[model samples]
Structures are given as C-alpha cells and as structure tokens.
Target: MTRNSLAARALPPAVLVQIPATSKANAHIDPGSGSFFVQMSLVGLLYAGVAIKPYWRRTKAFLTGRRSTPEADDESSDS
Candidate 1:
C-alpha cells in the first residue's frame, strides 16, 4: 500500500477515541455566540454577493464577449 493510505488507516481510530474521551471536559460558550455568528455569516455572504455582483457580471461579459442588455439586468428573462 501507499504511504497516504497507510497513514489514513492509522489516524481515524485515534480521532474517534479521543473525541468521546474529552466529552466530559468543562467548556463554556454563550448561546448567543452561535446565533451571532450565524447572523454575521449570512450578512457577510449577502454583503459579499452584493459587492461582487457588478464585478462578476463585468468579468463574465468580458470573458464571454457578451454584451449585457439594458432592459434585462440579469438572465432572468426568456430569450
């Protein structure tokens, strides 16, 4: 067998055993953190999409040599 396959075979059992062994360890995270991170991630994604949209369209048009239509901003209409 190859080195990667042998190594992969070796690591999974250690990972599996270590997790349950640490289950009773004291760890605290505020419940708000999960929701805050979720909201921030969603907002960041939306903001990124909004920010990148024009650049994406411009790059697509440039690479594909297609002119964007004035009436239809995106490819939502039936051609």
Candidate 2:
C-alpha cells in the first residue's frame, strides 16, 4: 500500500500502561527453608565427593603439591 494511505489508517496514540498496586500475596513462605538449603548444599558436596572418589588419591596428591599422576602411582605400586 501507499505511504499516504497507511498514514491515514494509522491507529491513535497508545495510553501509558501502569500496573495498579494490589493486596499482598496470600502464599505461605516457608521459614524452615534456610536449613533445608544448607542441608541440600552439604548433600550435593558430599555426592560430588563420592562421585569423584575413584580419583580421590590423585586429587589429594595434587592438592598437596604432588606432581605425580595416577599412572605413576600404579607403576610404583607394581614394583
């Protein structure tokens, strides 16, 4: 369509929309959730530790500044 025809059929300016304040939510916020979050985080950490347990010896060695790899440990144990 032509620009002039489009301009003639243009809609009126929109009103500024604003949300009206309403009463507070009636939902119950659990006060006991702080402990639950702490417990869940601890459990997650424990689970992570357990999941990586096969690599625990290398992990500990690496943290203690050891440069040896798991293969080296296995070779030494075979001697």
- TM-scores vs. true structure, each candidate: 0.43, 0.31
Off by over 4 Å in 2: 1-31, 58-79
| TM-score between candidate 2 and the true structure | 0.31
lDDT of 2: 0.45
The lDDT per prediction is 0.48, 0.45
Candidate 1 lDDT over 39-65, as tens digits, reads: 656544444444455456777778999
**Predicted candidate 2 versus true structure: per-residue lDDT over 1-79, tens digit per residue:** 2342233224221211123538865769764778756765654444344334436657777889877564543331111
Model 1: CA > 4 A from native: 1-32, 70-79
**Highest lDDT against the true fold, candidate:** 1
Error of 2 at 77 (Å): 23
RMSD of each: 15.8, 24.3
